[model samples]
Structure formats: structure tokens, C-alpha cells
Target chain A: MISALRTLLLCALAIAMLYAMRESMPGYGDITAPIAVRGAVGERVETQDFAFGAASVHLARAVKVESFGRVKDYSTSGVWLIIEGAAVAKTETMTLMSAEWQAGNGVRYALSQRFSTVSGYLPTERLEPGLPRPVLLAFELPETAVDKGTLLVARSLVMPLAEELSIALGDRKPTEIKPSVTISRSAGGAPWTLAAR
Target chain B: MSEKRTFWTCLVALIVVLPLAFVVRAWESLRESQWLAIHKVDIVAEDGAPQAFAGGQWKLLDMRRLPRSDDARIILAEFEASPTDPAILSQGACRVRLVDGKGRRFEPVALAEPAVRKMYPEVADRPRCGALAFTDAKGGAAVRMAESFIVPAEARDLSLRIEFPGASEETLVFRWTRS
Candidate 1:
């Protein structure tokens, strides 16, 4: 009986160890930071180098654009953007989103579709909804374009699944966020403050 | 002897196989690049007048008389195509876009703040856009603060969609802000 009990305990210990290790795999992807983007709309720059570089030029001085709706509930970004005398080739902003991040580069990136309802928010009902949400990522350019004139329409970015799990598991971080961009120059030469939440 | 030997072998296998299994699972999660949802928009202008309206908020603060050599109190955004023209002191407006180093494109999704734009379809396309300056005979010059805009912090990595008037599409192509 003593020997049989010891064997059972050993088996249980190994199984528990395996379970813990499996659970730890996702956290190995503990993503912490939010990724942001800035964009603009203009003509393809004229260039001879063959590859798209800054010198390749486009020409436009004014533009206007509008977007609205929620990206997620906890977040809200919707506005109508009007650019005056803005160079088409100049940097611009459109939208920004963030979720709880993983620690390493363990993220799986796939071209998944999003669906929005009349409210413009991602529905809590289904993952693959019937209606297609206009995922406008195909318009994103290179990082080099993140300069001035960049206008983005941010709505709601959901808490990453990992972060949500952490919260559910009682791990929460402070909400006071330090921004990546400085307030040196305003978008439309307009002086404004980024009221952080 | 048989039972003792079997127990010892099982213990060894448990330690070795467990670590090896973890190593394999860990390797499966690595990715070459991070894919982010974003878009690219570029703009350019050619009037030497500062752009007052853009996709975000903008204010015209007259700081020309503030002090000398400080960021020009006047602001010009070279979001794209940094001018390399030697004789072209100012080519008017410039371009801007949002992109990640890795190859992926975003779209004009939403607007975080308010913005505006101006154009003179009837004017001769040159001289300058945004703000312009002429070199005084003595070399010191006066500055003109024409247009400017304020970009919001949340506008990054998002697709920019602008509304323009009279264009064939009325939707000013994302990169159509040109010089």
C-alpha cells in the first residue's frame, strides 16, 4: 500500500508540473505596450530610385476627411478631419489602437476580419459576424510617414485578451500613461492638450 | 529488481521529456515581425502659406515676434518627401503617411480630432504653399505664418480618411495632400 501511494503521488506531481508549464506559455507572450500609427492621403511621390523614399514626391495642398464610431467601448475616437493647405506627401494621422501586450514576440498575426454594427462598435455577440467591418489597414504606409499633418480616427481598442485575463486574475496596472509623442507641434497648427484618461 | 529499475527509468524520463516538451512549445510562438492595424496617408501643398486646417485641430498663434532662431514660431510639416531642392528654398507643402517598417497597410478608419484644408485650384501652382519667405537683399528675411494644424496623440497607427470638396471622388485620396 505504501509503495502504491508513493507512485500515485509522483504521477500527480508530474501532471501538475506539466499543466503549470503549459499555462505559462501564453504569459511568455505578455504584451505590455500599445502600438500606435499616423497616416495621410496623397499622391504617390515621383521618384527615380525605384524604391519609395522620401524624395519621391506627390503634390496636394489641401484635403478633408471624416470618420466616426467606437473601436471598443472603454475607448472612444471619432471625428471629421479637414486639412487646409496640407501637402499630400506630408505625414498624417488616422487611428490608434492598443491592447494588453505580451512580453516577447510571441504574437500571431493573421489577417482576420472585424465586424461592426450600426453603433460602429465591435459586437460582443460573435467573433465572425455576418456583416464585414471595414478593416482599413491596407492603407497604412511605412513608419517614415509618421510626421506632421497626420490625423487618425481612434474609436475603441479593446483590452487585449491577455490583459483581460490578467485583470480577471487580479493583476492590473495603473492607468496613468506616458505618451510616446511630444506636444511640441500640433496637427493643424492648432494648440491643444491631449486629455489622457 | 525489475520493479526498482522501472521506477527509476520513469523518473528520469519524466524530468527529461517534460523540459523537452516545453522547449518545443516555446519555439512555436516566435514571430518575425509584429503586425499592427494601421494606415498610410500623405499630404503636400505648394502655396508657402502655413496649413491651418488638417485632419486634426489647428490654431494660428502669431509668434513671429517672439524671439529669433526658436523653431520659427512658424511650423512647417514635412511628413513626407523632405525637400532636397537646392534652389527651392520652399516648395510649398509636403507629404505625410503612417506605416510600419514591416510590410502591412492600414486604412482611414476614424478621426480623433477635428481638422481642415485649403486649396486654390485657379492659382498658378507655384511660388509657395504653406508659409514662405523671401531672402532680403541683406540676407535677413521676414517670415509668414500661413497654415498650421494640431495632431492628436491618439491619431497614430490609425487610418486617415479626409473629406474634400469638388474632387472627382470628393474623397481626397489618402496621399493626395501634395505640393
Candidate 2:
């Protein structure tokens, strides 16, 4: 009887250990989380899918876009942050579909959808292998979150386990916040250009 | 003796059978998802010959590289498919791409940029691989397709690949002589 009881206890112990192991396994989100590639502003960040280099960052109160002889002006209560970068696909032709501004306090702001009609937007343009093209990303964020923010770029925002490039904007704040900025989209000249308004 | 046999059988099932069953279930799930399935290219046309794939004969007609001012070049690929079975046309749109020797896959440029349109106006009229299959071709006629890609000037040894998702598990790879 003692032997049988001991056997029962051992069986229970094994079942408990198995249950604990199963419970400790990682969740779906944890298992399929994005692989992050980190870099700093002004430095070229290369991922398995693409290469990106952020050249400049502009902070403005309002934005004016000139495209196809039509000018559209946009104003936001929050500050307008414009990111100018160059992106090239590493192997295939693909679109960079996700851009977000991650504030220092961990708040994330997606790229503005208001500029969807504007040409040269990074997310809408197709990227080709070996051909680097200029890309622009605009984000509207609270003034308090402008300093010490990071820019995140990825081929997709919803794809699990995809590569994500994070470019840190650094701790310094901008010296000048333009009252208005104009983005001219001309076919004969560069894809688009930014100027103070 | 009967109790000993029962204990051993139960122990064996707990140690091995349960985990094996879970693994088999996971494998089936992955295969059913198709996204995680291994892409095995079954048909390869290496000698510039037409290949029978997806109930059709596929041939790479022409391929050329056009030099641009920058470090990038435009790769134009023209292909054709002569269907042996008309059912292949209704099998849904096909996915096509260019794969280099180094395992780099290039998707076709969707939008016609001004530079590419100015250089190759004829390409603008030709349908892509997906649309070509559904074009107004009657009586098993050959459907011509074209696609353009902006690849790095140094990209070499490129080949075309076409895949029909629900119709066939095999992928068709066509190699072309560079002109």
C-alpha cells in the first residue's frame, strides 16, 4: 500500500511539473514580436530587407504641400515633425509601409495620413533594390514629446516577426521651430524640396 | 503484471506520444497556413526552354537591362504562357518576381514612373503576368506578359519565378538569356 501511495505521489509530481512548464511558455505576442534594429539619426541603418539613413529633421507649426499645381496647407495644434531620409531595398522591390515617432515617454505616433495626396511620401513610394530614393515622413506630435524621440521604420506594421529599424533622434531639442514649411513637388527638379514659409 | 504493463504504457504515452501529437498538429497548422510552408521550386527552365507548369507552357521571351543616369538600372522581362488547360486561367491571379543568383527576389514595379514610361512606352500597354492569364485569349491561346523592375545596376544572373497559390504547390522558374 505504501509503495502504491508513493507511486501516486510521484505521478502527481510529474503532472505538476509538466503543467508548470506549459504555463511558463512564451505567449504568442512574445514569440512573434518584431526583431528590432537600432541606429542613431544621421547614421545609415541597414536591415535584412532595406537600408535607411535619416538626413534631417524639421519641426514646424504648419505644413504646405505643393503637388501637381495644387497647394494644400495643413495645420496642427501639435508640432509637425518632418523626417527626410533615403531608403533602398536590399534585395527586392518593396514598400516601406510603417513609420512612427516614438516619444521619449514611450508614446508612439504614426505618420500623418493627411499628406496622403502628397508625392514622395515614404510609405506610398516603392523601394527598389540598389536604387536609393529620397523619402519624407511627417508626424504630428505634442510639443513636449518632440525632444528625444525615435523614428521607427518597417516594411509593415502588422506583420509579425518582421524587421523594424529604429533611429533615435537623440536628446537634443531643435534650435528653431519654423512657423510654416513648404514642400514643393516638382517633376523636373528633385522629387520634393522643403523650404521655410 | 497487468498493473505493471498498464503503468509502462501510460508512462510511454506521457513521455513521447503527447509531445509527438502536439508537434504533428503544429506541422499541419503551419502547412495549412501556406505562408509558413517551404517554397519549393519544382520546375526550372535553365536552358531558355519553355517549361510546363500550372497546366500551361511558360516561356521567357526577352529580358534586357536599360541603363539609367544613376547607379540603378531598369530590368525588363517579357514572358508568355500557352495554356494547355483553360482552367488555369480561372485559378486566380499569380504571383511573379525576379530572383537573382544571390537569392535576392525583386518584385515588379507597380507604378509607371515618368522616366521608365518615357524610355519604354510599349511596356506600359503590356499586361503583367497576373493579368495576362485572364486576358481575352480564347482556345488555349498564348498570353504575353511584361514586367519591369528597378534593380541595382550590378544585379546579375536574374531569373523569373511564377507561383499559383491554390492551383499548384509547385513554383515555375524561368531563366532568360540577357540581351
Candidate 3:
């Protein structure tokens, strides 16, 4: 009985050590995720977007959203980041999926609840297989998170076991990143091209 | 004796660990649930009852309408020290009035002795219905004032104008339309 109890304790300790080591690893969330692809602020990537090869995504441009309306100015204790682009379906009709803003410190912030008009309706927009639909994603983030947060676009808000794309928000400065449009996919597949707006 | 010792050891361990785990979970829940509870209570009370959000030198904490058969809407407004600027939440001379979109003004109704005695008999006779109750605490002072008005059905845009001593008058507007 004593030997068996000692063996059980040793096994439990071994499992705990492995869990701690896994937690300490760098890029832990990305490494364990099913798929994680990264692209620059301007560089566009042609990949399976948000799922197990659901649709092909070509991100056109991303800019910081300051205001919701022309006259009405909305101010919060935190900063607002907006990414505008287009998504085209590869095989079937596509509905916009949820995305999260993952900060450098591994804090993920959901879409702001206070600003419903922008965050609520963006994901419900539909995209045809051939035509590219415009996508606007807005996230309200703390000032600390604006410096080094990556935009992770996925199908479900809490998406699991699916390949995810990490789009870096800021290039030069923390609060502001210039919007750029440069398309260069190494795979070189002509699936869809977003029309100039 | 050995078996009894082992049983007692395990029981003591369970007793200590269970309450420790519960305390940790309760602390975590209180951190998130406290703010959610305050906002939820505010929204629910305002939906069924006559409600108003007073924005001025002091922040409005709570407001409720006392149901009376006389058809007059008696609004009880509770004000607290504004987190942004607590200095403005002071005891001073003040005047509060309600104005309609067409510039019709309505003054506050004085508290009736018979109504106070009937409903809130436990309340001190010194307290009035539409009078400001100023109390000082460790952090700052809090001021609560109630007002009564007869709002007609056709009143479009209504606002509460509060004027404090040596301070500019602030207007809290209420939208009559759905949007």
C-alpha cells in the first residue's frame, strides 16, 4: 500500500511540472492553436481564413477608428482600433466571423458593448463567393494594449482547434498605425481581388 | 488507534481546504459581479418606474417614482459625490426646476405631512419630500434631492435644470422619442 501511494504522488507531481512548463513557453496560445499565420501591417496573405479552410481572405487595409459618426464624438477611457478590409468566399457564400484583439500581455478584449452599431452588425454582413465584401472591425482597447496588440480573426469568438491569423496592428507608433495596401501572396493564387473603394 | 488518526487527519484537511477554496472563489466573483449588479439594478428599476439620469456637478446614483393614486409623479433623486470631481459635491444653496420643450416650467412640490406619515412613518419628520439631504462622510459629502412634476402626455422634450451657488446651471435632457 505504501509503494502504491508513493507512485501515485510521483505521477501527480510529474503531470504538474509538465503543465507549468507549458504555461511558461513563449507564443503559447499560437503554438498550441491549430493554425496561426502572421502578416505585416501592409502585406496581404492568401490563406484559409478562420477555420479548417472555410474561405480565402485577403486583408486590404487597416486603420484606427476615432469616431463613430460625423458629428457625434464618442470618447472612452480606452482607445479604439478599427481595421477595414474585404473578405471573399473561396467555395461557398461567407458570413463575417468574430475577431479578437490579443494584446502583447496575452489579454484578449472583445468588441466594445457601448458602441453597438459598429461592432454588432459587422460580423453579420455576408460575402458572395466571387465578390469581395467590405469588412470593418472595431475594438475598444486600453491605452496599454494599443501599442502591441495583434488582431486575431476567426469564425467563433472563442474559436478552438482552428487555424488563426494574427495581424499586427501598430508598426511605427503605439497609438496610430498608417493604413497600407500591398498584395503579395507567395502561393500566387488568383482567387479574388477587392475593388477600389 | 492508527485508523482513527488517519481518518481525523483527512477530515481536518478537508475542512481547512474547502473553506479556503470557497473564500478564493468568492473574492474572484465579488470583483466582477459587484459592478454588474449595480448596473443591472439601475436598468431594471428605471424600466418600469418613472426614471431620470441627472448629470451635473454631482452624479445621480439612483432614482425611483413613488406610486400615488393622485396621479402626480413624485421622483426621488439620490445624488452622490462625482468620482471625476468630488469638490463640486458640496452643501450650498441650490434650485431645481423642470422645463418642457415649449419653455413651460414646473416647480417642485412640497412634501405633505399626511403623505409622509402614511407611507414612511419610520422616516424622521424633519425630512421633506423635495428637500436636499446633505451628509458628510470620510471621502466627501453626498447630496440627495427629490422633485415632483405633473408631466402631460404630450410633453415632448423635458429637462431638469439645476442651479448651484456660484456655479453655472446644468440641464439634464430627456428624449421623448423612441430613438
Candidate 4:
């Protein structure tokens, strides 16, 4: 009898945890997602025209996100659209920055070299005309003297085909790598391209 | 008969008590997922601790916002302080306002007390510049001020800028992009 009661108690606790975890799951919200980019170009090239009247790459409203242990379900938000990027060819070596992540387990772990560049919609004023505003392109290098553009390496994060998804507290375990980002050439914003540095 | 009675009694308690416990737990979690709990945050550094800056704002360079679910506070608005700066902050003299994708700025469309209270209860009409220096040149102790704004139920794109007093010859700009 005691064992059965304990089992019932344990089951109740598990369900409560699952439900609570789902309610408070932390996600990086509102990114025009499922953005696709091509890395074949050996040199810096702009893709403004794809299958759509759109530019070089594309971004769907769909977001591609992953958690610490696994990928979560697609967020209720619209898929992020239009992802723009510059290819570094195969030979360019990329440098990565390191950071720490706090997990739900109350343990801190190092997420080293999460990626080489920044992720988000770039600000206008850095791109050429006919280029999208703040294209969803990541850098292959850092702020160093490297001829024309800043230094960035050739690396890409894969957007996992999420079969199942869930959410959790980010304070305990923030995201380390985002497989993709959203971008666009014109939403009536300024162009975001590299300045002559 | 006694054994059967005890069995039923325990069974009834299990069915009734377990769900009640669950209700209480779910109530707590619901509260947690709602709006942020902190009503007003005033960070100030005293003595030798690292002090923070007051009423500051930061904008990212490359990030696109397509309106979706409201989950995270994408931009850490009005909370700008560098490790090289102080750790603590002061927001006694200042307030903040945010301009998001929506036309609403400081006050919402209705200007209702509850609505205004949510976004700009502590923010000043304008981000005023104060002569008070929070951090010293060496990055030691300092004072600062600001009103932290909590995100409401609305789901939309957000582009924000904070205005504060100028402290140097060049324009003070706060920019950051996270990968």
C-alpha cells in the first residue's frame, strides 16, 4: 500500500513538472525564421534574387530553435523569413567566441566558440542599393585589418528538423547556438552592409 | 471491514489531495510565467562595489523582428552597464520610455492607468540627462538611475532608443549584437 501511494505521488509530481516546464519555457521570440542561406560562393556575393522575387536567400516565418539537450517545438509565432549571408568559400578559417550557460540543473557549463559571428537582423546603412535592409547574414571574421571586409571564418549551424519541441527557463540554460536567423532586403528599413573600415 | 475502510479512506485522500496539491502548484507556475515580478529596479553601487550606470539604452545592429509570440525581452533596454563600469546602479532620479513597432510610445492608445503603469510607470517624460556621474574614470564606485519597463501582453516588433544627457565630446552610443 505504501509503495502504491509513493508511486502515485511520484506520477503526480512528474506531470506537474512537465506542465509547469511547458508553461515557463524560455524562447528567443519573434525571429523571422527557417531562413535558408547558400555557402557555395567562394567570394563575397549578394543573393537578392531567389525562386521568389526575393533576394539571394530566403527566410520563412518559421523559426529554427534548439534547447540544451534537444530541439523544442516550433514556437507559435510566424516563421522568420529571409536570411542573407556572405560566403567565405571553403578555405577561410573562422574564429569563435566563448561564453557560459546556466542550466536548469543549477550547473554552469562553458559553451565555447558558440559561433564566429553575430546573429540578428542587421541595421540599415551598411549595404549597397537593391540590397535588403539588415540582411540575415553572419560575419566570417572579427574587427581586424583584413583588406576589404572584416575577418570572419567559414562555418554554419544546421537547422535541425525538429520532430518534437519543448520549452524551459533560459536563466538556468540560455541558448548557445542558433542554427539559423531571419533576414530581408526591404521592409522599408535602411540597408545594412559592411562599411569601408 | 476496518481494513476495507482504511483502504477506501486512503484512496479517497489520494484522489482528492493529489489534485489539490497540483492546483496549488499550477497556480504558482502560472504566476511565474506571467509578467515579470520586479515592479521597480534601482541599481546603485556603494562603497567599493562595482556601480552601474543610470537610464541608459542599447541598440543592436543586425536583427530583424517579424511579429510573433511574446516570450523574451529581446533588448535589454534601460539596463546598460559594462563590466569595466560599475556592477551596481542607481535609478533614483531617472525614468525611461520605449518606442516599439507599434505607434504607442510612452502612453498607450487609451492612456489607462493600468496600461501606462505596465510600461512607463517609472519612466520620465523624456530620458533626462543628469550631471550626476555614476562611475569614476578608474571604473570604481559610482551612481546611476533608471526605470525598468516590463513587456505586456501585446505581440509585435520592437525598435527602441533611450535618450540621456551627453557626457563627452563625441556622441555616446551603445551598440551590441549577440551571436
Candidate 5:
């Protein structure tokens, strides 16, 4: 009877300790720290690249292609905004980084599909340190989205599922998240400039 | 009497611990199962020239910015096209289909003819509409398929379906965000 009682008491203590440490543990909830950094166009901002090395983005401009051949414009109610820029890598080799544009209206537009077929346009390019890779990420959005939108360029096209799982399982170290870049139209509206971080 | 009492206690402990150990082993096995072997799927704009069947012939799709109502969005998707066999040049054709949030099914424009011409323009009238294979530096083969489909401006959610030869059909969901 005494031994049984002791075992029960020990189990209760273990359960209590686990409950107390739940919040302190990494995978307990979604209350983790923000991983992205914020910066403006033209100004090169360093981002969290994990083991791929240091990365920087320079937002160039937002342009709308009026027409291509006899097909006319594809977007009926919206226009395609081709975000032109370059990303430079330092140290390690990098894979294609997915880019997304979030308008001030809260609508998020991914890279455009129509314009990717155009020659000399590269949306996915491996970035190695030294050489700057030209970025031509396009987004299909309403004309209202052009003037103000935040551009997010990250290594994963989708949520980092593997990393999230590893972090939850406590199997791998958590990777730092770089800040997203904010893009705004210039005074004359010819070019989009990155907002100050 | 004391010895009998101790034996009963020891047997009870063994019964509990043995089941716990089996449960842990089963959990580990499930975690390592092949059900988790889903390949990476990516949706991006078709780079270079997009070839599609137009006017009873294969032609290069114009890189035009068309309205969603007028023309469908042309997107390129990448997947693990590496075949288990190195001798297999083609991994067969893939059927690309999409279903919108509102239950609207959108079939990708016909790509078989264009696919053949793009890969083997020199070979005339061949109907080998399989995925175009390219060997990487590591001698592993990868395939690329260019497909076009229409998505309404108000589409809240989109699910892309890809059916490769000899493999189960897979559906990839695109969760759209308004803000």
C-alpha cells in the first residue's frame, strides 16, 4: 500500500512539473517571437537566412505591362504589377525565395503567373554570395494595390513546415526570421521605393 | 502472505509498463511511415515562352497581361519527377486540375501536343505527351509541366490536383488571404 501510494504521488508531481513548464517550452503554443525584420526599398536589409548565409533585398520598381502580342491584358478587374529588383547572397548558396506583396488594403498578392513566361524574367534563381540575382516577381492585383504594398521575400514558398515541425518537436534549432520589406510609390509614382525599416 | 502481495504488485507494474512501451514503439513507427513522403509542390509563373495548343496547332503563348475574365492564368508548377528507373525517359503525362472554393472545377488547357513540341520539336507528329525529363548534375531526372487555368477574382480557396502516371492523385491546397 505504501509503495503504491508513493508511485501515485510521484506521477502527480511529474504531471504538475510538465504543466508548469509547458509555456516555457518552445512548441507549447504559437506565442513564439516574430521572425521577420522590416525595411524599405533601395536600402539593403540583412535578413535571417538560417544556414544559407546572409541575404539582402533591393526593391527597384512596380510596372504594369500594357500588352503582349494579340492576347491583350489578362487581368480583367486588376493589373499585373511586375516588381523588379535584385537579391544578393553572402556566404552560402540559396534556393528560390518565394515573394508575396501585401497591399495596404490587407490583400496579399503572390508573384504573377502571366509575366513569368516573358524572356529575361527570372522569379526563381539560386543566390550565391557576391553575384546579385535580378528579381522579377510579378503580382496580379487591383490598380489600388500598386501605390502601397509590402513585399515579402522568403526562402520557402510556403510556410516552413519542416522547420515548424522540428521546432515543435524540439529536434532542431529554431531559425531566425528576417524582416519583410515594405514598398511604396515615389512622389511621381514612377518607381516603388522600399520603406524605412 | 507478504510474498504473494509483492508478486501481485510486481505483476500489476509489469502489465502497465509493457503496454506503455508498445504504445511508444507504435507511435515511432507511425511517425516514420511513408505517408509523410509528400513531395514539394511549387506554383510559379511560367518562365520563357509558354506553349499551348491554339488553332489546331502548337504555338507559343503570348506573355500578355490579360484579365481574369478574358484569359486564364498561366502558371508553372514543379514537382519531384525523378523516376525510380533510370532507363525510363518519360514519366508519363500528368493531369492538372483545379477546384475553387465554390466548387468550380477548372481543367488546365490541353498540354500534350505542346509538351511534345517543346521537348522534341524535331520529331514530327509524336504523341508521347509525358513529362519532359531533364537530368540534374547528380544524374537524377526531374520533370517540368507548364499548365494554364482560370481562377475567378473572388476565389477564396484553390486546390490544385496533379495526377501522375502510376501514382496516386495528390491535391495541394492554396489558402488565400484577404488581408
Candidate 6:
């Protein structure tokens, strides 16, 4: 009877040890998460694939995109955040395929698809090595989530073990929001400029 | 005593050997699936000679650098491939890129680009590296291909790398000095 009890106790101890190990071990998602390279607005962050710098962040009530002699206006119930930046591919030609606006409260907002027709949308623009190109990303977010936002940039949404840039947008007051903004798309390696209206 | 020894061996195998083998296999699979995984055999071209790779003969016909209005330059690479086995064409498109001395890689620009169309009008007539399979060419007929890239002016010692979907494990590299 004593031997059987001792065996049962050992078995229980082994099970407990396994349980502890399982809880402490990193999960698949955590192990494969993108390597994040953090930076602030206006600071150039270099990753394994590319280098990116966020030049300015603007908040507007509405956005007008001028593409190929046509102008399209996009108005949102929430505020529109325009992020102007430059991206340079380091080793190969690539595109910034994913961008997200993470609010201070941890709410993530994806890049607005309403302006997909815009020719110079950042996510749609191709980046070539050793050549710097202007980037413009627009996100629609609630008014409360405007201040203290962080822009998350990555090569792809599902990339594993790739570098991601997290650019922090400093705090801004409600008064800084503009009434309207216009983005003029340029042609043939020209930089796109944004104007406040 | 023999039965006792056999029982202990079985226990050792179950408790240690089996799990070790499984862990090793899983680790290998994870490494292969990672983003930085590279599994390619490289074949370098010497003296502009044609190379045999992926059941085809590849040769670099011409490489030229053209000055652009801007500081950037255009690299036009023209190559040809003669397939020994025509069935390889069905394996999908080929990927060709230029690597500079500084390890920067440049992908081919669209054939419809204004510069490519204006400077190399014949490029529009030739099939791209991977599009040869779609043509009605029989085996051993050399099909010409062309690619153009916009590169920085300082890029030098350029090499062209070609990859075919049919031969996923092999790549051909043609090296040339900027003249």
C-alpha cells in the first residue's frame, strides 16, 4: 500500500511539473510575433527591410484626394488622421503593405480603404532600394483616440519574425484638428504634398 | 532478467527517445517556415558564359546603364533561355532581380514604364523571363527576355539573379562590372 501511494504521489508531481512548464512557456504567437522597432514621430527608424520616418501627423474633419485630374472627397463620422512620411527600401524593392493607428487606449485602427483609388496611397506605393519615396497614410478613427496615437507599419499584416515600426504621435489638443485637408498626387517620382484647408 | 531489461529499454525509448525525435523535427519545420529561411543553390556565371540550371540554358545577352533626367539611373538587363525540357515552362513565372555591390537588390520595373518603352522599344516584343512558357516555342529554341530597373547612380558591380519556380532550389547569378 505504501509503495502504491508513493507511486501515485510521484505521478502527481510529474503532472504538476508539466503543467507549470506549459504555463511558463511562450506560445506560438508570442514566439513568432514581429520584431518591433519603436520610434517617435519625425525620427527615422531602420528595420531589416526598410527605413521609415514619419514627418508630420495631421488631423482633419474631411480629406480630399486629387488623383489623375479627378478629386474625391472623403468625410468620416470620426476624425481623419493623415500621416506623411518617407520610406526607403534597404535591400530589395518592397511595399509597406500594412499600417495601423493604435490609440493610447490600445484600440487599433487600420488604414482607411475609402481612399484606395488615390494613386499615392502609402500602402499601394512600391518602394525601391536606395531610392526614397514619399508616403502618405490616412486613418479614420474616433475623436477620443486622436491624441497619443502610435502608427504601426509593417511589410505585411501576417509577416512572422519581420521588423515592424511603431511610431508614436505625441499628444495633441482638440483645437489642433483642422477643418479640411487636401492631398495632391504628383507624377513621375515627385513628392506628394498635403495642404490644410 | 531479459524480460526486465527489455521493459526498461521500452520505457527509456517512450520517455526520452520519442519526444526528442519529435522536438527535433518540429524545430526544423519552424526554422524552415521562418521569414529569413534561405534554401537555394547558387550557380555563378563566369566570363559571360551561359549556365545550365533548372533544365535550361541561360545566357546574359546585354546589360546597359542609361542616364536618367534625375540622379537615378536605369539598368536594362536582357537575357535568353533555351529550355531542354519544355515542360518546365508550366512551372510558373521566373523572378529576376539586380543586386549591387552594396547588397541592395532592385526589382525589374514594369515593361510599360515610359522610359523602358522609349529607350528599349524591342523589350515590348520579347517575352519576360517567366512568360516564355506561354509562347509556342518548342524545346531548345532560345527565347529572349528583358528586365529594367531604376537604380541609384552610385550602384556598381551589378549582378543579375534569376530564379525559376520550376527549380526552387537553384538560382543563377550573372556578374558584370559597371562600364
Model 2: runs farther than 4 Å from truth?
A1-27, A186-190, B1-25, B29-39, B111-123, B131-135
- Top-down DockQ ranking: 6, 2, 5, 1, 4, 3
lDDT of 3 by residue, A13-81 (tens): 999999999888768555556466776555554456422111222222332222332323445555556
* Candidates 2 and 4 compared by lDDT, better number: 2
Provide TM-scores for the models. 0.22, 0.82, 0.34, 0.26, 0.32, 0.84
DockQ agreement of candidate 3 with the native complex: 0.01
Q: How many residue pairs clash in each candidate?
A: 152, 0, 0, 60, 21, 0
| Candidate 5 chain A least-lDDT 10 residues | A164-173
Alpha-carbon local distance difference test for all models: 0.26, 0.83, 0.48, 0.31, 0.44, 0.83
User: Model 4: how far is A95 from its true place, Å?
Assistant: 22
Better of 3 and 6 by DockQ: 6
Q: Between candidates 4 and 5, which one is better according to lDDT?
A: 5
Of the candidates numbered 1 and 6, which has the greater lDDT value?
A: 6
Interface RMSD of each: 15.3, 1.5, 27.4, 19.1, 18.2, 0.8
Candidate 1, B8-98: lDDT as tens digits: 9999999999999986776545332244323334342222222323222122222111111222111122221122231333322322222
Whose lDDT is higher: candidate 2's or candidate 5's? 2
Q: How well is candidate 6 docked (DockQ)?
A: 0.73
Q: Which ten residues in a row have the lowest lDDT in candidate 2 chain A?
A: A167-176
lDDT of 6 at A173: 31
lDDT of 2 by residue, A100-195 (tens): 888989999999998876677898888877778888899999998887888899999889999999888774346789999999976653488899
Residue A1 displacement (Å), model 6: 16
Q: Interface root mean square deviation for model 1, in Å?
A: 15.3
Candidates sorted by TM-score, descending order?
6, 2, 3, 5, 4, 1
Model 1's CAPRI class is incorrect
Residue A73, candidate 1: how far off, in angstroms? 22
Give the per-residue lDDT digits (tens) of candidate 6, residues A8-89: 9999999999999999999888999988899988789999889999888888999987877888888989899888788999
